[model samples]
Target: MFRLQFDLDRIIGTLEREGWVVIPNALSATITANLRTACLDMWRQGLFHEAATGRASGQACRAEIRADSVLWLDQVAALPAVQAYNAAMDDIMQAVNRGLYLGLVELESHFAVYPEGAFYKKHLDRFRDDDARTLTTVFYLNEGWPQQAGGQIRLYLDADCREFVDVGPEAGTLVLFLADRFWHEVLPARQQRLSVTGWYRRRRSSMPW
Candidate 1:
């Protein structure tokens, strides 16, 4: 079984203090390479669909607002790499919940492929209609990605959006943040980009029914 090799204490501490944390080498090199290969293979097989904006009835494909293709991981959980990734994320969820008491109980994730020039505008992960999503996590799988790639995730540190940080789409890098509190965007890249993006969710206090 694949295992995550990272300093959990430091990571949890940073997240508790900053509300966001970026960790390098969050996954082993072998697992990162495997995930990258899986993403590209799936893309070549035409398993990805154009990603949409909004939620439920409001969702629609708006290229101007965002441009990326995605393959939901729900149906592919048995894949070896995917299972390993899920296991790692579960560990993270448990740690965060133990440390922060966020009540995160589940994870929803997808493989996102950004073709050249693809981008996503600034937005929060939690939907206006549904607030179950409590935390956002993004693990990049682009091997040997460079600073010049331009496919960095710009994370806004404050509500006013003045303070920010741009994180590169580099392999083995994981970004974690409070889902509803942060505004973020994907900067357009000259080449393709690949990552597994997910949200850790809590049970809703009341159902829509």
Candidate 2:
């Protein structure tokens, strides 16, 4: 088996320098495809409910809350797709050892879809209710995408603490970034865009000042 390896120092160094890092193809094609199918299936089965928010551009999506996914636990936990995603996270966490510096980290997975013309306005992923959110992970689930698709993910780096970087929404692309450092948003989608996103939460015990 080809053991996928990453330069831990480089990963940590980049996180400090750029505030974010991209691990290309962290999941194999086979694994990615399966994950895509499973994610789409979850959406199709009506497992998710539309979220009421100020941002909406004709895209339809159901936010799968991490704390309330009990209705279809078997559908999500038994699938190899979720396993693969978790595994990828394991690999990343193992390499960077972000845990060593941050205490008691947690992740909440949310599946989202934006159909044609759907877009998300500029915003931050961290929850304002609390400062527990630290990092954000966005794993693209689309395949055979084109540049003009317009479903691009723009992630700004300290762009006035509002917006700065634009990450590609291409299939199999994974974006890892600081959740509260800068503002980010998704542009209008020429076609449908699907992705799995979650936050790596940090507690006071780990990120104390």
Candidate 3:
């Protein structure tokens, strides 16, 4: 198992104070390279589908609002590189639960590819029908992304959506934040942007059908 190198205390502290944190070099170069290769392979194979909005039954592709393509990472056994990445996330999840007592029981992730001019509009991650998603995590895989690249993620700081922070899509960088608290958008990209996006979800009792 790959050992996690992040500072757990600092991550938790930042989450408590700012509702989000951007960690540079969060993943090792080797892992990042492997992930990039895997993503590209999947893309070449036409495994990615246009991303959609809304929850479970109501989800539908709305290309006008968001144009990225995504392949859901449901089976870790499909790729050794992805499996290692998932293991590392498991460790982080355990640490987060221990520190914040968020009771995050599971994580779901997808490999996302945003082609030139693709973007997602301002929105929160959690859906109104389900409140399971507690935290959102986005790990970028684009190496040496230039400042001129227009695909930075813009995160609004408050309810009024006035002040914000724009994060570049840098390789090995990870962005974490409360799912329901932040309003964020992806700006149009000058080049292709790649990332593994995930969410930590709290367990909820299922209603009898």
lDDT of each: 0.91, 0.66, 0.91
Backbone collision tally, model 2: 7
lDDT of 2 by residue, 1-209 (tens): 12234455766688877888876665677767887788778878878665434223533433321111212223477677777677666566565555336442556676677767777776777654557777788888788778888777777766574545566676777787888776777877787777887777767333343
Residue pairs with backbone atoms closer than 3 Å in model 2 (clashes): 103-206, 154-166, 155-165, 155-166, 156-164, 156-165, 157-165
Q: Would you estimate the TM-scores of all the predictions?
A: 0.96, 0.78, 0.95
Minimal lDDT window, size 10, model 1: 1-10
Superposed on all Cα atoms, the candidates' RMSDs to the truth, in angstroms, are: 1.7, 5.9, 2.1
What local lDDT score does residue 92 receive in model 1, on the 0 to 100 scale? 85
Error of 1 at 106 (Å): 0.7
lDDT for each residue of candidate 1 in 1-209, tens digit (9 for 90 to 100): 14677888888899889989999999888878888888898899999999999988899999998999999998777788888888889988888888889999999999999999999999999887788999999999998998898999999999899999999999999999999899999999889999999999999766464
What is candidate 3's CA lDDT for residue 1? Answer: 23
Misplaced by over 4 Å in model 2 are 1-8, 52-75, 98-100, 159-163, 204-209
Highest TM-score model number: 1
Instruction: List, residue by residue over 79-129, the lDDT tens digit for candidate 3.
Output: 988988888888889988988899999889999999999999999998776
Worst 10 residues of 3 by lDDT: 200-209
Worst 10 residues of 2 by lDDT: 64-73
